[model samples]
Target: MKKITSALVALGLGVALSASVQATSNDEAVAERIKAVGSVCIEGDDTCGGAAAAPAAASGPRSGADVYTAKCASCHAVGVAGAPKFGTSEWTDRAGKGMETLLANAINGINAMPPKGLCADCSDEELQASIQHMIDSAQ
Candidate 1:
């Protein structure tokens, strides 16, 4: 059994050395044998959906009203799914819940509200700005 193990190890080492020796040839022939199977695409390419271009143009955080229009307006603007319409009596009542409470709820989420309105990328400062925007508009 010991002899068999030694033989197997020697054979493995021989095969490895042979492979490295063969790979040492810096000829274009080896490269020609291997074809490029794929490639990367840049932004504006039809396949990428132009999403990559969007981030480069992301251009700092949007204003509260802008973020609200782009993300929060879907539910908050119209109170869909019981989101509490912006600048309505319901919103005023919610504001009465206290700013800290509202900020926490908005950032961490409240019933049916989903954390950060499902905008996981939104910064806390941005969330606070949106909340303040809501409060300011309500008042």
Candidate 2:
């Protein structure tokens, strides 16, 4: 009877320890799930949630000519999807509409043009410069 009692007590202690470990592991998993999964960082805005540190800046803003050739030329060079061809009547009308309108359209996208002309990495200033470059070349 004494031996049996000792064995039962040892088994109960082992079970309690196992259960405590499992509960701790479960709590850690729940904490991980409740943590933020991602974050957003907008240019010129300092209100991004503190999910991550800011990325290092690139060398610098790419030149307008380089940006146009690399990004805008695909559509604008040949007037794909109604994109104004550089140095033509189409761009003349667009240029007459004013730079602000053009910049806004380029940044936000207009008609079939994707936002930022699908130049996901280009900044607003770079896009504006590219637009100006196209307008200058077309004239």
Candidate 3:
């Protein structure tokens, strides 16, 4: 009877320890699942805890041909929706409007062409460069 009692106590203690370990593991799993996926840190906020994230590198303003190829080619390539076709007299005719008027038209949406001609990120100088590129192509 003494031996039987000792065995029962040991078994009960083992079961309780196993349950405690399992509960801790389960709690950890739950915590991991509920953790935040991402966090935003404003510049100079300092409260973000760790080191500040590095700013994105600047590659400088894109060339006219590069901007035109990426943004303007879609509509301008084939003159879709009345867009002036590249390498045509259409650009020459439009050139008569002068740089100021053309720049304004390009900056503001003109007819079917949207503002910046699909280049929302293009600066005024870059736009002028692209305009010159197309005009040059006409020759």
Candidate 4:
């Protein structure tokens, strides 16, 4: 009877150990399956994926009309937040400040406007052109 009881105890211990090992293996497999499959590539890095290269600038700076429509129209079109409306007298005072000051204000942001008019990626030339587009439209 004593030997039989000892055998039963050993068998129970073996089963528990086997179950614990199996659970650990399953947890590791699940973690491996859920791991991130891709990584971010910093600009200028050479090892990034082929399609991840920075977009080439267009053959020329984007047209002011294009830039304005894409970036400034939302605010300037309807004078949202006091933005000067295009094709109207609302910009006369701002235009009176001269193109230099207008460009500077648009680039650096003034009042409720954001720097570069919220077009962070716009080049200085592009911003200038966009401002000119607004001025032209207003006049």
Candidate 4 lDDT, tens digit per residue, 1-139? 9999999999999999999999999999999999899887887888885665768656778989999999999999999999999888777777899988888888999999999999998998998898888888866
Give me the candidate number with maximum TM-score. Answer: 3
Each model's TM-score, in the order given?
Answer: 0.54, 0.57, 0.58, 0.57
Q: Rate the local accuracy (lDDT) of all candidates.
A: 0.80, 0.89, 0.90, 0.89
Among the numbered candidates, top lDDT falls to 3
For model 1, residues 8-72, the per-residue Cα lDDT tens digits are 99999999998877777645567867868656677567875356446565577778887787778
Worst 10 residues of 2 by lDDT: 48-57
Count: clashes, candidate 2: 1
TM-score of 4: 0.57
Q: Candidate 1 vs candidate 4: which has greater lDDT? A: 4
Q: For model 1, where is the 10-residue window of minimal lDDT?
A: 49-58
For candidate 3, what is the TM-score?
0.58
- Model 4, residue pairs in steric clash: none
Better of 3 and 4 by TM-score: 3
Name the candidate, 1 or 2, with the larger lDDT value.
Answer: 2
